[model samples]
Target chain A: MFSKILVANRGEIAVRIMRACRELGVATVAVYSEADRGALHVQVADEAVFIGPAPALESYLNMERLVEAAHHTGAEAIHPGYGFLAENPEFVRLCEEAGLVFIGPDSKAMALVGDKIRARQVVEEVGVPIIPGMKKSFPNLEDYRQAAQEIGYPVMIKASAGGGGKGMRIVYQEEDLLPALEAGQREAKAAFGDEAVYLEKYLEEPRHVEFQVLADHEGNIVHLFERECSIQRRHQKIVEETPSLALDDDLRFRMGEAAKKVMQAVGYTNAGTVEFLLDKDKNFYFLEVNARLQVEHPVTELTTGIDLVHQQIRIAAGQRLSFSQEEINQRGHALECRIYAEDPAKNFLPSSGRIIYLREPVGPGIRHDGGVYAGFEVPIYYDPILAKLITWGETRDQACARMKKALEDYVILGIKTTIPFLREVVQHPAFLEGKISTHFIPRYFSEWRPRPPSPEGQRLALIGAALREMKQGRERKRPTQLMSAGQDFLSPWQTLGPWRLGRRS
Target chain B: MNFEFMVDQKRIPVAIEKTSQGWEIDLGEAKVVVDAHWISENCVSLILEGKSYTLHVVPVDNGYLCYVQGELWSLGRPTQDLEYSQADQAGAVGDKLKVKAPMPGKVIKINVQEGEAVRENQTLAVVEAMKMENEIKAAQAGRVKKILVSVGELVDADRPLIELEEE
Candidate 1:
């Protein structure tokens, strides 16, 4: 194990990896941008270093600064958690050159899989089922239109170097292809610094299922079963679960085996996910490879009782597979809902502000992996995800019921979130029955919204507001507990950590 | 004490009194005597009409936001009417149309100048927030009266980016 590890990321994933490093008695060094001063991740780490300005391109995305920060902190390993530098093969190469262990696959493997078009060609050679599409990116819109003509209508446009739905669009007509392709290329360039993109046949109503795998340097790889991630909005998954209600035992085993084959073909290492889209007739096609620890790994952790972060760090440290495949048993069903700092009522626009209140759900089956505090500012320069809520139970019904209740119990103020939207999802009859697909949000919730607050609800809210005002008025007359709600400074309570957020005891 | 608050921009009245049994609150349509207890800082537990509920209140800009269950409503005092605070709220405010950035972000593109005609739903500008670009559109056919912000400048959640005089 490394004596020290530098987390080249920010927000919840950075905090999450730091927690794992703490558990392993490894010191964690956090690198932050100007926007992330006093962020929860900064406070939670053993040491902190300033990277650059708020723009991620100058800060988190700068490979040189991240490597320098790791060197300054004497970190032997760098854990690129999920977003910024996780899948960037160049960053991996830089870390290797700096003699710092990059806690993921080698640059060669990352480059091979990072290019989705190339991965498809290679996955096909291994005889794994894949969606039929263009073999390479086209030079112009006219070329793209011709390719789409061959693929038929309702084709999908995807960034060649994309994940997390940034550079992805579905066009059902030739008229929409040009604009959609241009937009995809632009987003891909902004997100991945790559303008290349390819086309694919849009699979209708396919359930998005992905398998988790762990491979070691000693060449041992094992599949950790599947996670059903069909619930999505804007092509990004919002809800996910393990032991998909869509798959039976026989089908699960085959998909799991196929997922291992896909990773094995690419020489994938550490922790990565193989996504597959299962059609209405139960036939599955390769979606893409998520070449990092995913945002929804907690769902798999609760069911399989394996700490994936621990495995990532250990694997990068040249540790062999600590356990065999037969020993890994998924005991129960698990579900995860991504909590984002966005308002669902207003097209899910990002809500950036200081969080004035936060109350995480807690119980025997609920888990919250959070990044924001009561007074922390959610910066506008990065992904809007604030946390993820996961729940586990003996049965799917038990898990679903717990998830709904936990959502109701979860409270966050000062910014809009998707708690209400996710609550509506788990309560839907189709969701409870597991009849979901990648188009679930559009098909079911195109115009779905929370019912207007009843008269009783309105009254209570107004009265509550009045009471708060009255309290404020009294405080103005006689200040107590340092009563000043007008400032955005860090209160003593925020510096006093482990109190506001419901950290796992 | 009588308090008038704007709930989602619609003003409503709330009156509270100290009664023999805890506090009595009047909400125009109904009157009830209730038990209110402080469960935590800014969090209240109330028992009214034989029903129990928990409400969380936090101070926001020129107002407070109260949350219960899945509902969150903002309460702003009518004393200082800063219309800019309503920037991210759906729909144009007070009939004077303004194209505002939905969230705080760096402005990437401005499609029109101070004196330019635009169609309803025209993409007036694009602001990148949280790494995703959001296009600000005109509510109706209008002429841009003022370009309040420039491209590549950072903006807040409700700051007006462009002022429009509608047809």
Candidate 2:
């Protein structure tokens, strides 16, 4: 076991990794940007280091700064918690060359699976079903149009260099193809700096299900079932769960086997996820593989009694697989709702401000992985995900009910959040029945306006506001009045029961 | 005594009468009981139907300082009457349309200049918040009359960012 490890990330995931490291008797070193000087993750780590400025390009993505921080702190290994620099193959190479263990798949494996185009080809070669599309690159409109005609209408133009719904477009007809391709290429160039794109046949209303796989240095790979990530908005996942309602015993087995095959082909190690798109007919096609830990890994952790991060660290330390395929079994249903600093009413745009008040839900089978406190200011530099509210129950319905209760119990002030939206989603009939897809939010609830507060309710609110104001006025007039009232242990309003002026009462 | 309370520019008249059991307050169409307990020299606790609400009072410039749910709100001397009335206006009568920001974020890029003609759904600006860039577009075909915000300026939800004149 390693004595110390460096966490090259921030936010809830960083805090999550730190807790796991402490439980495993390992010390953690946290790296932070200028904006995160007072961040929760920084305060929780055993050691902290200043990396760079607020912009990710200047700080979190600065591989040299991270490597130096690890070397300076004498960290034996570096754990890229998911996101910034987590899947960067170059960073893994740098860590390897510096003699510091990268706590994930090696640079070679990352390079193999990190490229979407290459990964698709490799997986298809291994008999994994892929979406019918072109594997070769489309350099111009002629090549794009030719491929589009062959792939049929409603083709998907996706960035070959990155994932996360960025640089992806869906064209429903020929007239929209060229413009979509152009826009997708532009976004891909701006986001990933590589304008490479590929074509894929669009499957209407497909559910996104991914398998969690872990391997060791000895080529042992085992999958921990699947997570259904169908509820999304603008290509970002909002809710996720394990043992998809779409997957039965036979289908689950087949998807699990396919995941293992992909992992074996890529010579994968540590913690990674193989994503698949499941159509209505239960036909699953291979999506790209994530080369690092995922944001929703906690759902799998709750269902399976395995510490994925601890396992990743151990695997990076050249340990052999501890559990066999037969030993791995999902005990119960688990679901996670990503609580973001966004307003669902406003197209889910990011919301940022100082948290003036926060009340997190707590009880049985409820887990909140958060990084912000009452006084923390959520900066606008990074992702707006404040925390992930996950709940586990004996069954799927029970888990959904628990998630709904947990969301209601959660409260945050000083900025608008998607709490109201998440509350509605968990209570949605389609979501409850596990009948969802990528278009769930935009298709059904896109125009679902928040119902206005009724006039009677508003009148009640006004009365309450007025009463509060009057009490405040009296207290201000005589500060000693409050002091004396405090001594009496009676409310000032109660003492002065009925004082009257006039009118309509 | 009957005192009328105005909140968020709306007047709410409440009637309070002393009773042997407690205080009976007529709040519009409902009658309820009020239980107040002094929490400190600056705060009081109000309990209603098993739920407790704490109120913090302090002195402000022209009125009293109030804190509800940890948020500081001000209550000044009653001046203007609180009323909600519909405004009668005409459509497309050479009036400048206010373009309020859809959400709180820092303006990243401004793609249009003042006096430039823009079509509906045309990109006007990009607001970068929460690590994603949201492109703000023109709601209707119009000419840009004024740009109220600049790049890198942090804005709140519904804050005016631009003004558009009918084409």
Q: Name the best candidate (by TM-score).
A: 1
Q: Which ten residues in a row have the lowest lDDT in candidate 1 chain A?
A: A485-494
Tens-digit lDDT track of model 1 for A1-505: 8999999999889989988998887888999999999688888887899999988889999999989999898999999999777889899999989999999999999998998889999999999899989988878778999999999989988988868888888999988888788778877877877888899999888999999999999889998999999999989999999999889989999998889898899999999999999999999999889999999999999999999999999999999998998889988899999999998889999999878888888898999888887777888989999999999999999999999999999888878899999999999999998888888899999998767887666788888888887777777787456634322234343365433245443
Instruction: Go through the candidates in order and give each one's DockQ.
Output: 0.57, 0.27
True contacts kept of 2: 0.30
lDDT of 2 by residue, A177-249 (tens): 8767866776565445567888889889899999999988887889999999999887789899997989889
Report the CAPRI category for model 2: acceptable
Please state what fraction of the native interface contacts candidate 1 reproduces.
0.72
Off by over 4 Å in 1: A473-479, A482-505, B8-13, B28-31, B81-98, B111-119, B141-149, B158-167
User: Candidate 2 chain A, which ten residues in sequence have the lowest lDDT sum?
Assistant: A485-494
Give the C-alpha miss distance for residue A393 in model 1, angstroms. 1.4
Off by over 4 Å in 2: A136-142, A174-195, A454-505, B1-9, B14-25, B35-100, B104-109, B113-115, B145-163
RMSD of each: 3.8, 9.3
